[model samples]
Target: SVNSIRRTSPTGGTSGLCFKKLNITTSSYRIIINRLDRKVTVNYRPARLPFSRHSLYVEDTGSMYLIHTPGGVSMQWYHSTGIMVLQYITRYNASVPTRGLCGCCDGNPEDDLKLPNGTVVREVGDMMLFLQAWRVHTTDETEHTRRVGDNCTTGDCSTCLSMLRQRAFTPCHSKVPPEQFCDIMWAGDLHYKDHQCDFLAAYVAVCYTHQVCISWRRHNFCPLRCPPGKEYQPCVSTCTSRTCLNREYYEETTCSFIREECVCRSGTILHRADSPYCVTEDRCVCTDNEGNPRAPGEVWNGSARSCCLYKCMENGSVVAVEPDCNSVPTPLCEREGEYVLDVLEEGACCPKKICECNMTICDSEAPPCDNGNRLVIGYSALSCCPEYRCECDPMACPPVSAPDCREDQFLVEVRGQKSCCYSYL
Candidate 1:
């Protein structure tokens, strides 16, 4: 049973907009409308009764109409319990029928033009007639909000009347309204903890004066770039050279500038083996092992000693010598040294061409030899060469040729003499 059905407003307004709701004893549903904000909030409750838990049925209907002087506008909408919804907009002017039964306004009347005498006149009473009708009915049940009222400001009925006048004259108005697109989409779905519900329907009307405007737009154009060694000069339709240095030249092909091929002033087309740069007159001429200028048909030795000098191998063939001399069987290990040349016979490999000390020879004096069992001890020098040596320590002492002394007398030995006994007291 729909027990408590009333309307209230948490935020009071002069426009007399009251939120309507159906309040049952155990559950209540309410709809809140903020006219100034053009927003609608709906609160709903599920059936609590055991048998009718899922059988709750609800519906809502809203209508608004205004007709006073110059024009009038009306909006209406109907919604069923989670089912179908219908909405439409109606407008009329002074020339139309008093009740606007056709739901359309008459032709746009002429605007008042002020003349020099301060009197207003109309060029034509009626020129163009226009009737705009918009209606939408959907059964898709995709929980959506439909705009039921045109935008209106908070004032008096006169404000709505002024909007009605603008809407009526919309077809004949000279100034274009600012271009507006649905940039913002508000979700009308009602949500509860785990329950999903739809906003069945809503209606609203707005009246206010506003200027017409169009949208802003422009085309996108990107600029191009020039190739390497080139500078782009706009409006000339061509890439220019950046004045290349040395043997570099600029080549412009297909609107882009690139470095020209390496070409030497000298007519020789052959290039050095190590580099791609063409051989120029200023460079040294290639030569053979005898230091003579190389002639045509001679194989160029890539492993030459100098940039253009070749060497003759032991086999009587001329070729570029290997850069690392240590690879040769008879490498030059040292220039001048007594120890270096003397020790080199140990191995055929080249001795290091650096100063070195003989580490096998020890420079310390020998220790005393043991009776018949001399042992070599390991002792090393403090020098950088750190020569290790062998030394022996005597473990035996000389035998004494004397008799033992008495208990009360101590035996004293004289320097460079034999031991003798003496009385102390």
Candidate 2:
């Protein structure tokens, strides 16, 4: 039988030797046979047909071995690659139906089809997919046992040597330097003091988780702690201390946030005298220095009697003159005394002579005064006193002839001539 062929060396002139064969019954085998002509033949048999064509090569240079089974099964392994071994099959039914070797374990195939040494191998058409999903497990079953579970350990596994040999993976701590820890802590403390302490606590917790180390240079956790020279006062509207800022220490005080003060300007008097400060009505009454009451037209001065007088006109004239002396006075003399006496003596008095008694007097002693008349006192007048001559008569008379004069006839002589006078006695 091809399985029972004894180990025999080929007979040839060059240093030939005979070898005995041992019986080994395994489903798969690899044999090397030598012939007399110094020819060497190697044969391989797989327990199940159609094994993966890919194989793992353990040479210095990295290479992948491929095994292709007749039934479309495939297996792959790497020599010095982090992944130690891998086995897979294309058909669901086949020889040792196990997953590929675990990278977290030695070279043993995983018992469960689903999980292989914590590595998951999936079967594809005529191929198997290998990935690093395995974890190491050490238990009593095999002191260094490999299991397929979620919480498998990779501590002492040879296949996990790569992971163990490399340094641990940590986040970038250089960006947030150690020197900035004080500042970060101070800010957090201030925030906590002013706002919610929980927020600051959460922030500190996150920083610690990220490996940020904080130092305690100050006595208190907050930056605003009472120092040697300074005292801790609750933060009021005016917070001057630096430590209080760190701890976010604050004190509430009464604040006139919405209240405002009202004041009057200089030279202004407050209308409301009772209230000294101006609130609602801030009126200012302008006044002079004197306390006297000022009239509408009057201006008050600094002195008590110092008042300005205003002049007003009445009927377009000044009001300074007395009212009784406004008109002219009567003359002193009663009547025209001497002037009237002088006028009566002179005949220059008209037809009516001025009487000594202030009345006009007629001259009756002379013949009744006629149009033409001359007067002789005693002799010239025969019939009637002086003016009895016809020619001297004041009235014009006709000449008396002898026959007409016999009734009353008289003769009179006057001025060296005889004259006839006629009288109607």
Candidate 3:
């Protein structure tokens, strides 16, 4: 069964992101988005060599936009083709799947993320800045197009293509020849066929599984999903082997049947801080020579006061910002007096009411007594409040004597008016 999920930001603005399976399904790609820092990292690894070149594409209809890469996020094979990372800073929130052609080129052998003014990005930082500037440019361009009443044609549009081409840049890592590491990265081992480990160490550093390996040949490469502050240690056998990943020689644990288990990555044990940083992918602390943690946003010359620290209030609780400030702070809803019902999961689309009052009951009680009936008040769990019912009282009202009236007919006062009705006949 093929499963796919698309997410949109309900808080309005263009802050939504989505994930989908591309045409090249054999290769695996992971998209990590940091909405706060406006950075998006796309990691791709092909099952085989000579992977197709794919560029990041976006289709921005007035409603939404999309991110597409023709082949995959892996930009290997060709020097100019491999650009797997993209980061953008935007004034307005970035939404996707809008109705316009806004994607990067994948098949172009000479492809490079550049700007219209011929600015080239040589490093990751430059790439981030370029993408941020591109977003502003495209947003302005889109607004202008909207004002002119021009229908934006989506899917392989010139505007998108131009932006993609202009904003193209060569990744810093492309300079490294894949031959030095390609075989180890893609060994095309058949043993891992049944296993679901994207099997590419490029994306996952280490993996552990319930099934143990038999002599390293029949290893069950189980993918490990680490919690915050931790990362996997890709289990590599020998350095000369085709799958070497430069992992540290940490003590291995014994799983079921005395099988070896890969150790999780960890940072140096800090003196004062008990919970030291878990050295993992996407995490590298800007530390001082003394091994003290330093803020990435702040410059450390000699003192700690210069360290940039974020003081944020999230959900009425003050907490330090995420490591490296690569994440957006979740908004907090003040809980004045009312009791809190439930908080939506972190990064959820809709704003969950942090606090809410008890269920309100109807002010007017007694169901109007009808047909010489008396009102009975009761509580209901379904309604979470009190409810009313009418019980018959034959002596309360006189019987209705009208043409074609049943012998059991009685006059019931409804809304202060007498009405003829059968009395339980």
- Clashing residue pair totals per candidate (backbone < 3 A): 10, 30, 32
Ranking by lDDT: 3, 2, 1
- Please give the range of 10 consecutive residues that has the lowest summed lDDT in model 3: 74-83
lDDT of 2 by residue, 284-379 (tens): 222223322222233222323432322223222212222232232333322222112223122211222231321123122444434344455543
| Residue-level lDDT tens digits of model 3 in 234-347 | 232311110111123333333211112232344322121112233432123344454444433443333243333342232222234433432434444343223545554444
Per-model TM values vs. the true structure: 0.18, 0.15, 0.18
Clashes in predicted model 2: 30
Q: In candidate 1, what residue range of length 10 has the lowest lDDT sum?
A: 198-207
Q: lDDT values of the candidates?
A: 0.26, 0.27, 0.32
Cα displacement (angstroms), candidate 2, residue 384, comes to 99
Error of 2 at 41 (Å): 9.9
**Cand. 3 TM to true fold:** 0.18
